[model samples]
Target: MSKVTNLNQFRKQQARVKKREQGSVNAEKFGRSKAEKALQESRATKERRDLDGHQREHDE
Candidate 1:
């Protein structure tokens, strides 16, 4: 005789794994990490400050 199994639970588990894999794939395709974004912002700010520092001050 064949053993009884809960098919509904198995289907739900498989769906969860598939959704998780899809989420990871979407993240890689569409998103940057917080650290990377923060680093880029800081680099831009530093560049702006350096440019401002190099400018000659206007005299009245």
Candidate 2:
């Protein structure tokens, strides 16, 4: 029989390939809705504003 030095390496490579294939399938299947997109943007904006407010308070 041939040597199998690194089974872990083979498993990792398989996992990476599988993950990429699944990601592509998911991307095609259920993309974001407009409402979800808007909600995400709003949450990001709110987080930034909160951070800025905290920085301003600390600077004073």
Candidate 3:
């Protein structure tokens, strides 16, 4: 005897698997680690501070 499957459940399961596969592909292509993000943020902050430090103040 052959087993029958629930069509709606089977379709939902397949969609979940496809979504997971696409997520992994996108992550590998565009994702960055926590450390890399923090390092870049800190560098930007420091650059901004340095530029601000070089600006002149005017007094009346």
Candidate 4:
């Protein structure tokens, strides 16, 4: 019984390792370019500014 439990745990760990390897491969395959990274940062900054403006309006 304990052996079976240990086997199950080992299988689960193996599956998780495979999953992380696949995720890393996929991330490298579709990694962002510099332009894309800059665009994302700009959009995030705009969103934060918009949220701050809205909050200030509500406080007034």
What does the lDDT come to for candidate 3?
0.99
User: How many pairs of residues collide in model 1?
Assistant: 0
Choose the strongest candidate by lDDT. Answer: 3
TM for candidate 4 is 0.48
Tens digit per residue, CA lDDT, model 3, 1-60:
999999999999999999999999999999999999999999999999999999999998
Candidate 4 off by > 4 Å: 1-5, 33-60
**Rank order (by lDDT, best first):** 3, 1, 2, 4
TM-score of each: 0.54, 0.45, 0.83, 0.48
Highest-scoring model, TM-score:
3
Candidate 2: tens digits of C-alpha lDDT, residues 1-60: 988669899999999999999998998898898999999999999999999888744454
- What is the Cα-based TM-score of model 2? 0.45
lDDT score, candidate 2, position 59: 55
Residue 37 in candidate 3 has what lDDT? 96
Backbone clash total for model 2 is 0
- Per-residue alpha-carbon lDDT of model 1 for 1-60, expressed as tens digits? 998989999999999999999999999998899999999999999999999999999999
| Candidate 3 local lDDT, residue 3 | 97
Candidate 4, residues 1-60, lDDT tens digits: the string is: 344458788899999999999999999998898999999999999999999888744454
